[model samples]
Target: MKNYKSYIIGLIALVGALQSCVKDSYLEEVNPNAVSSDNYWSNLTESEENLTSVYGGLLNQYLWNSEVEALRSDLAFPRERTRPLNYGYEWHSQSFTNTISTHYFKSWNALYRVIWRANQVIDGLNGMDETFKSQERWTTQMAEARFMRGLMHFYAHSTYNHGEIIIRDKIPTSSEEFSKPLSTSEEAIEFFRTDLQFAYDNLPNTQTQKTRVSKGTAATVLGKSYLYTEEYDLAMPLLKDVIEGPYGYSLLTGDDVSLLFTHAGDYNAESILEINYTDQHARLIQTTDSWDEEAYTTRWARYTAPTNLGGGGTSYFVPTSWLTYEYSNEPVNPNDSRNYISGTNIAKSVPLRCAQMIAVVNDEESTYYNKTPGYEATTFSGTVFSHFKKLTNHDIVGHEDEVLSTSWASGKNMIVYRLADVYLMLAECLIQKNDIDGALGYINAIRNRWGLMLLGADDGTGTFNDVTYTKETLMDHLMYLERPLEIGLEGYAERANDLRRWGVTKQRFEALAAKEYNVVNYNYTKADGTTGKGSLIQEGPTVNVKTDVNTEFDDAAVNFIESVHAYLPLPTDEYLYNQEVN
Candidate 1:
């Protein structure tokens, strides 16, 4: 696994330079003094440099991907009502107004920014000086650009922007071109798959910089597209191409599974694609907010860490009771090392965090924790129980003021695609084909590694016994039960997408709604191995406890969860300001 640290440094500079050039009109103005696009992207080397900006666009997308995609889904519950498009809170407007909407606008804008840059790179590539670089290099760069372009469209089409989105395959130089009519969903999905296939066939098996697109990266996207579309046969081989490819992808085992998230694992063998964020600050809280010194860092950690820990770091997201319960590993065994504090092999208490975090931070008998004995889950009442260690970095207790310790210090290379995710998708593809043994092989491999009882095997935990499954039951198990447990909270909206694909999005969320107003006391393990109590439901009277989403869960959730309303309504600006949509 290579970090390609130098490449990322150069990327930051290029992204900075590119972003500084504001567009006053649809056509970018060319400064006769500066390097213009006409003269700059005239060769393979230059075109490749331009491709870095596309990757920069991807880095920006990652800034808001989890909040916008995952939080609104069943995977996470937002503790605050800041964003219009967030789950588990009330909203000011049913129609997404500009004031309250941030995640939806930024996600849509950033991905399209990638598409915009990709189109520039692709158009420029046509005129690249072949003699400056190898034919293979030029083609590979083109493939990478196409993959980025298609990936942006695929997600934007499926995840947000429910209605038609303007498909920009080429750089738009005129105002007329920028405001074209929207394309249908069928057109978008097929367009997305076509671009991905071209890249899958052309990209190298491995690249010097693991962050760059490769054969495995392209295959995973193509396969995922098919999987979401329910094209079982088409999905299997493409997914298999990534599964058994020469890229050396393997699930992170033992401590490696936990380390899979730290900066040390940025380009590890398991990674297919990841948005690279350096120690540099990533974005301002908004265009109007004072410029943060830590431009390359994300505020995710600030939102996740509990208030008692240090900086009032505990408002944005709280682990749902559903997520907390899933880790209990109840049915298969009394404990499955994955939970927060009460497991045998892995003592588990809190609901959120990577498995190893529990092993390190709060272990059984309190040997490890008793020695440190700092602020523990004791402070977490109804508000914050599962302080998600995925981003919290529990290994280091203590922080400075509110602004996270020295900015960007929360620099953990977030995982976008990894080995376990690939394996589960492969299992899904195989199960659809009635390949039960083969599907179970992949699934059991993951289960066995995590100290979980195999499908039929039962340890001493009364929660376990033996059960058999037919095709439908297995599909149900994989989509609802297996995937949420394995891939939940890592990032993105896969859990929501999983439910949607299984045709259970509305039903599952509606079930969750029943518990919206209900309150629960925090029941956690103590340092001395005794069960201790914490705070009770603490939402003030201002909160509409019955509504489970940012806006009234009933209507806003319907727009977000329903299949036809899969895309969020276009930003308020789309119709009010953009001449095209109006």
Candidate 2:
């Protein structure tokens, strides 16, 4: 079994173990004596503690919420696709046989337990007296609870099983409530909308920390839910509220853009909702050497980073030619300005498929960037294989001494939702409404920040001209081209869900596996310690050496991919255990 202990972090040991949306009896309260069962949640301080646990649910990393999200999308290529632990990713990536693998059960169980806790928190807050806490504070806490409940509901709805999932607004203390029938698609979407509406109405305009939810956060999610359900008219106004709202959110500019990945930029202005991760010491409490709280830090850098670069990573997840060459286009200089070395250290280079791993720089040390033959890598296709740079702060990471294997846990805070995403979605909404000019304004806002040309700007590359865009044309660019490039491999599972909803599984993956595209501006240092830039690209790069590049799209995987339709099968265990799902 892949370790479920770490995945089940910060969960309180209730009377009955948390399972599905059905049990309120596990509401473990203080005063083991008979102080009356009804008044357990009588104070505000205790209610806040319950609220914190609901937020703690976001800390689990082993499930599909984090690294696996990237692995399943076209944005990332896992090193080992057939590994038992990776089945959730494989299933979503259109490769799994009709089987209930570990991933299927893990993701299903992890999220539902979260919903259970959210229900408990909502119930506790509702029963608490207003005199114990301020009317303002109590209501805000309730809004946050509803927000988590809604968000998890949406996540479960979109991530694994879609329409068949249940919605529990009230605390389920009865067996019938726990074993309720699966809801209809319309019912599930409305459940998501209802919770988000509650959150949007009561949440404050802004919060001191990005970890907390706000009106903009709720609005952003509500708008996305509306768009997903094809309620474009409703989505447009909510998106507009986020775009022009008083959330104080703005896209980071110039070299500051990399703050989205670095620890220095935690809770930066662009972040609307950021999941916080701390160091090993802060993430978990050590009661003894062998016994400790679960390490709730994110394992993203460990899976995505290059093993050679002190990250102890497999560097398994790389970018595709379709994403890098065919779709992630460049400015006219025969180079991707987005991926190139700008005059400053940081820019839009992170979204680039390939990355440079910089070594440590101290007074007594020789500060050198890694570019070894076998150690420094390239994929089989001959174009320089890309490595993800957003996972770490561009430093060497080693494992903790107690662990035999390398686990470079950087514990970086992940930005869940932000203003830039709002802008892009707004642009999409505008395109659907045939407001092309309004759409371009949002699109260009992202492009201009990264030092790329605005939509109408004449770069000699012939990338863009003064042609007017119809709904189909704008959507084609935005869907396949713009959004994929802008939001690739950021660890939100955003890209994969988009592909699943768009229904482009077979066509997209088949074309990606067919041929390799050239690596843009492949950079390396010579044996003499001199940097070299191999220019005039678009030739496929074949791997001249053995490295961690073991994944590919073979015939069986692709054929099965085309066979899949809208609903991903629920785990067989779900049917066995729940006794109510179809």
Candidate 3:
């Protein structure tokens, strides 16, 4: 909960300076003019500082805060398909080529940089005196470092690369150590599991800084790794531990759910691990005009805010119509009075999460930017009628141009893992384990928070909405609906990863392409209890029929060759520089 962004800022600068001097290497370099490996690890303070640098990798906007990762998935796509936006959208169309390096190189390099930093801390700690190394502080920091190192490898190998990845477990001092061949998939998972196991065994339940990894964080991520590798039995108990552990993590409900992506929600009870970004941008801006002032902040808002609201023109990645329609299809919470328009039985017609996650031009009634009259979103991108409201200060900031009115680099922390994600994963595992009854509880907990209809009916009917519950049916709901609705547009390419792991990427896109999304004329009650009609895109007669089936979706469905597109290739420069790669 403490402000550690300043420490992250300094450590990032140190890591950059160290990396700049290293030629044709992936490991951290020892600079003759600066602190060297021989003297840097003398005390606990220095080791902890290096560990902070490991967490700084999460601040890589290209990886987390920006749309680079999300855009790779089906949840979002570039608002404009211009040449400048080619790399980001290429992942969708399966036209990926290493010639365009901005998205590919930055994200790949960022993951490895964290791995290198974690390796630096682990190596430095291993070199300390036996007496010092045996202390609680040393063990804890080592556990933290290994946790980070393992998580990065998980990202590089399992999440992004989807195959062999270099296992940089130690700092390379010689040329032989500098270049290593990629580890086999089996070897990579083994190394990943081992590192996370150590962290889980040694890390304490709590940390002085909440941003640092804890026992629950290790368990959640380690459990997720197991899920990715098809070790459902192994994943079940670990995820359960975090669910029923001493950690006080719980789901954020009601208004708090809407605030999850805003600055106020940073380090909240549901959050397991989050990257710390400083909220002192206003004060820092006054002191200097240099980049340091914005160094600790994230430009996520500047990139994700709607173009109408002054977001970057080149990278305007909005939520795809497929995603918005998916969220809209959630059964309205019939029991909640707020779901109904004032003095009428008519429901607002959009689900609670749809209102919270994206701005539907016509369906929403809430006061956007706190305007006098609600539902103020004027336009969206292309044929898409919704814009991503998550990770933007649209609601909190009292202005039409939220990103421009606020700091250039916003300070909202990016949450990597949370309790809701764990619940959904548990449901997934439970369904895989054939515990249909048990899985329903986990899935329904998420729905109950929003007062939406539960998956299964009461009285042990194993039915909801007159549909019988089966393992396949429940799995389909969790896989296609619950997971994307609850945690979409959050996490690190999780939607894309989920589709791949389920072996349904092409099928999912095909289904999305075939489906028709109706942009209906709807009505909502305004703040003053007056009726307001929203007909942003009126259809032919009664229903405005709009198929979200675009060229992007059509191309992705047909051209997404699993061998080539399922996994991102290692940056070309990596093979060029590393002799072992050839």
Candidate 4:
């Protein structure tokens, strides 16, 4: 129902259909021979093709649909922002049910397809001739395939009905075994750990091809897998190795940072592993008309501030005021310089204007030097909101005629892993292990990289900003804020999982939702069209007319976030076909 055409094609290609015909009575011959299991792993080219097919399986739309969106947004259990239509909010209200049957089927089928392909490749490589035995090449390819398989398992485990779901083993001719009983979360996590560990052990530290996975990439992912499994001790060393490894990766400079989200930066050194997409790449060809455009068409308007002025519209995802306020409330004298406001003021509503005006009066200068024209003193009315500026590159305005083109054509490379993530994950593991000083050291290292003031005693930034956090609470908070801010929309899909894993969805929503005002800053223009300093507006206690504020949050709001919702339901069709197994 959800367009299984591509998936079917991938399966057919990867798992060729075979037919047998009898020629002679004594010695029957096979005719119209389909791909046989015996011949599946015969060579290097075949193995490479299988690996390519595996990666292709992950780009299916069924895996990135409304159900996934609900998992990410605040309308359910993890309310980071207070918007009425947030999927989290809707689920919380019981307005909708998690019946994404089609999506579930697609996700399950595609992952199995990837896993099957990986098995074929692995098997084929094992049987390769001596001439094909380049340890470096074979190991790299195998590692990449394993990483892909592990990533799929991770998603499967994370999304499958709270981790009680079927484990697709190899390829199935019928839906029988595939539709079997669900595995426990612990089982799924173990599978993921094993796969990732294999990848980490075999992958190279660096590669001439940026798109390929390296030792660090695999190690980082293994660390993440361990973190998800709550194996802090196991995760920490792997993460630290990634941080200190010679992957030639580091934080992008102030100027180069903007390039990270664009098409030109795809598969750069900073990117550990990423799903490659290109306007020109055949595998990534998706007709824009079919995909949802909410994110693309408005020039990433919903995600950031307005065009020409910085902020954009709020119909799509908007960062919560609580997040903004946290940044604003950073210890002033010795905060990360990167924490300062930058870029243009695009909040055109009255409430936003009021908040910006207030921020300016409070001396919150623009962090980015360049300001968009015609955004001085402008005010937005409805709910004041904050947005990520990382995706606000102007070159992508209306680049596609279909669902908003957050497409790679806009120069935004989707990062699956990076050094920054590695550092933070290590910090998290250390904290979970009750190594407070060790955790702080890793966190401070990241802070220092961003030119921000360090925390804890002896970092020379004075007392620890008066913020007291137990090891678990502080690590949780750091991951929540830092991951979003650092990764932005690129990792938006994972937010809900992080919230669930930390058991802080309800707490974050409650704490963040009670605030009275949400502020957004943007450059504004006067009646004469002259742009000047951005003014803040307030949006809460009712929508302010002047700023065009349209978002709000209240204390009575309850999150319908369920621990169960963290895992997605197994596809019903699989079970239906395999009723005997069920």
Candidate 5:
């Protein structure tokens, strides 16, 4: 119940040496000369070092990982078909399967590690002198720690809440407590909400460094928490404050938005909270030296979309045919700039060949592949694949191999919260509460900014005009079509959870899987003497790439994925360790 501000001030003033002692029984060895709790909080420098260690622990969490491959598996793979990999192996790819047990365990462990470190910091602060607690620095640090703890819990709940009941109570000192019993989904959510509320109350509006946490970030996260809980009314005002308050955030221009994923202007004004990556400091390294290196390079070149110029390969994250068709079919009046900005305008200059390749793949393939053929050179053939184009750093092209190296750092800040996300959430909430007009206004505000035409009528552009609907159904559709396109891979994990909650993934997949589109061959080979025919072939109205693809969300699939598996299980090991304690 102690307020964050007061707690901070108290710890700062009483800055006594805090020892970081480990139990001899718990570890193989101990450092005799290591700073003990007695000296840890005693001096300013030592206290700061302890805090630094806490920050390092925060970064080690699953949510902060660079590659984020687990996210794709946990969120994207089970829900939608962007590509076909292990998806054909129904048991292996299903979220409920034991195949992903390690992923679930790793995620759980990593988050608990973060929480444990935060708890240490919190305890350290608690043990500090009352006089030092009133200081601004101490207050901010404690608040930040609390916020991080909340964030870790938020992710934990999101991952394990499907049906597997898992929970970790606070920070576990002994290995036993680390593996406590799983909390119910509702309980986990409440725990996260509690931490976020503390963070919101204690954190400041701004921070001196961009890397640090602040009030706006806390509020934004809190709003997201509320949105996830389906408490839209509570979320709306908090999100609005983040957008309109002293946060100093604005939507980046299309060009600037593209630059955001590159290392160009990463920590700019538009960022609310970003997992900061630097070329010099904390570089993203390949997990292994040889295979990972090759995989990384191939993926970079083949998966990402080509840069503004034509020299690079296109590895793009192609929008689904359903998404593309929806956009194309929408009303696009000449007067509406929103439609133009939304999808019509070509903000970046891409090669004609690349564009054509993208169209072909989206139209033809039932399951998207990361690598495909494109324009060919004398020595090398272009492979067209889907990549997060926004995150590409063209400046480091020649040293593309070293792009993931610590030295060749690109400054692509991953945005955790943004203004647009909030607006959409508000709209969703309004619609849920039967506030149709209110919802429309919120949606319109976003569209208006993009120069889109009005929603309900057919614009003469051949695309259907926006159609009005009752609040309930309209909200559902908006979340279905609009949200996916708008947020894309940013909140992909969250989207998957929402789909589960709405019980729509199965239906959505069925509808999309049944549709057909045009497919063309982009791989052209020259004949011995003259120009040869390209490998352009139209496969299907609906191409079935695999004969064994699982179309039905069968009981096997359900069993493989627990209802609680929708949320991540608390690391079984943690609860195992703590069984005696409980």
Candidate 6:
């Protein structure tokens, strides 16, 4: 069992206990028995307890619990064959219509919940006794709260609300305070930097509890914030620090790379920050309140797993044909033995990253949901079909056969930030700075992990594998090649952010829309001695955009208005409630 204790139930019970302390006697001028923030925040224990609640807010539906980020990117498509097409179709197709309003509100609301709780903890910590404030525990907790606040603001600005979000620096005491005006992107990033800088300055290089944020986490995020705003000069130092720092971080290699998504990989050496989940008491009971429901587990697996694989998964989102082709497009390292399909003399197949990412047919080397040797059978055939395997526990155990009664909940922790991402980000920064040679090392470091051919004649062989790169070529490789393969579908809207940042969202989508996809079925013998579709390859009349039932092929090519869709609109509730926003 995971040792890190998430105070999910403890947070709920504590809030209930405190609220019970309210004594509103009609005759009293002031209730001495009241449990206000002033009285309750008497020491470090209270601060620590409240901080845990702030962390709990990360598991919200619009946050880590779902793949809203992936749905928005070209990397994933909503499984249109499944029901409730409205879940991701709007964002996936970039419709941004009245149908998507609730999604916008939920996203805005969830992120702010984290920001508000973080602000509450910060305010409480600030108002505590002076001696307590002087203690090391107080400083550390303050940094943690600040880190969360800045991080959430960054998410709201860059990911969801797109810089039209209000910066909630403190707990609001009145309606006016709560309804503050939106900050410009510059104002928001500046506000976020102060908090993140404090966090980077004060946080330990490493934490006793793997779940807690550390110095490396703060640095990487702070650098990322700068990178997002195009402050490449400002971003370079911080990212470089993470690359060379004594944070004890390194990339997981070989078969161990498969462990990155499993329960056993939680808080591994590569991970900088992770949202921890557990199945010790996984429950199926759903509540109207998002925070109160299944605090120790996530529905990410059930939502992303392949439905046809007999896993009881909803198959809400699956890897796009574009993404699969990108993996296949990667140049195979002929020297490496792992590059080939098992039991096949064919020298090159999809690399290790592709095998780890999605289940493919006739792959005797990889496993899918206890189906050893490969995904030999699935109901999804005749059309090109592949489901996400990265975030789901489809390799370790079948979703239906979990120890818990519920099939929806999973204990695998979500890795929000890891060393590979930092390496890629650093490479991007170096490329932007015109240090093309400087950037190749960071990029090649990732390639070296899979024993793939290095770029730009860096390898001693000097053959260059017929691949030579200039500054422009290297940057192209960084954006389209390195970023997608390594950190593609992993984080919060990572691929979407990259597409937007590179000014290629519309182009990328249209390109994907134009491509044709195909399905190939391998021959296999049944127990009854019947031969299945043997070496049958079917060309798709289907294009990528129409893969999702809700999306029109023309929608991606025509309806994607880059100016409006690139940055999502602020929630309608913001205009409805905030006097200053309108």
Ranking by TM-score: 3, 6, 1, 2, 4, 5
Best-fitting candidate, measured by TM-score? 3
- Tens-place lDDT per residue, model 5, 32-107, is 6433454467644455555554444433223432223322222222212323334322322344443444544555
**Compared with the true structure, what per-residue lDDT tens digits does model 2 show for residues 1-582?**
112232233344232226552223434433353222266587766566666666766665543345556655666555433342354346435565437445556666667666766777787777666684468888898888888888887877876556568676765555555666778777887897788899999999986545678999999999988877767899999988987789887888766765555667777778787767655434345322221113445556655554454333433455544554433244522233544445643333223222222211100111112232322332222333444555543433332222222345545566677777888888988887888889988987886666554565445665455556778887877778778777665434688677766776566666556654333232333334554433112436434322212234443235544335334567776565454763
TM-score per prediction, in order, is 0.81, 0.79, 0.88, 0.72, 0.71, 0.87
The CA lDDT of each predicted structure is: 0.58, 0.58, 0.70, 0.51, 0.48, 0.67
TM-score computed on alpha carbons, candidate 1: 0.81
Q: Give the 10-residue window scoring lowest on summed lDDT in candidate 5.
A: 376-385
lDDT of 3 by residue, 1-582 (tens): 456654645454356522211345435444564434577888988877777767766666755525755776777777642222665577656677665656666667777777877888888898899988879999999999999888888887765556688888776676567678888988998998899999999999887678778999999999998998789999988999998998888888866776676666778889998777654643454432223422456666666665556566455676766676666667755677667877888787577777777776545556555652335645442354566776666666754344334445565566678899999999999898899889888988888777677766554533245456899998898887888878886767788788898999888878766655444333334445554334232222224224222444777788777787787777776676667875
Residue range 505-573, candidate 4, lDDT tens digits: 666556545656633334434434554444343435434334332233333236344644544555655
Q: How many angstroms is residue 18 displaced in model 3 relative to the true structure, after the best TM-score fit?
A: 6.1
Task: Give one digit per residue, the lDDT tens place, for model 6 in 371-474.
Answer: 65454545344333566776677756755336344546666677788999998888888888888778887887777677677777636654245566677888
Model 4 regions lying over 4 Å from their true place: 1-41, 61-96, 100-105, 126-136, 174-178, 253-256, 280-315, 327-381, 384-411, 458-473, 518-563, 580-582
Candidate of highest lDDT? 3
- Candidate 6 deviant stretches above 4 angstroms: 8-35, 80-86, 98-101, 160-162, 283-294, 309-315, 340-349, 377-380, 401-403, 458-464, 520-553
- Residue pairs with colliding backbones in model 6 are none
lDDT of 1 by residue, 1-582 (tens): 334453455454353222111233624564344333576775666777778767766555343456445555665555532232233242211234334556555656666777877777787777666674468888898899999988888876766555367677876555565566667878888788889989988989888776788888889888888988889889888888887879778877644655555556667767777766544332232221212322344555555565554323222565554554455433333455553343345544332222433221222322111233323433544434344545544443344122344422444456677778888998988888888778877887777556565674344454334666667877777876678777765535676566666777667665654543323333444566665444223222324333223222444345443534334666655554456667
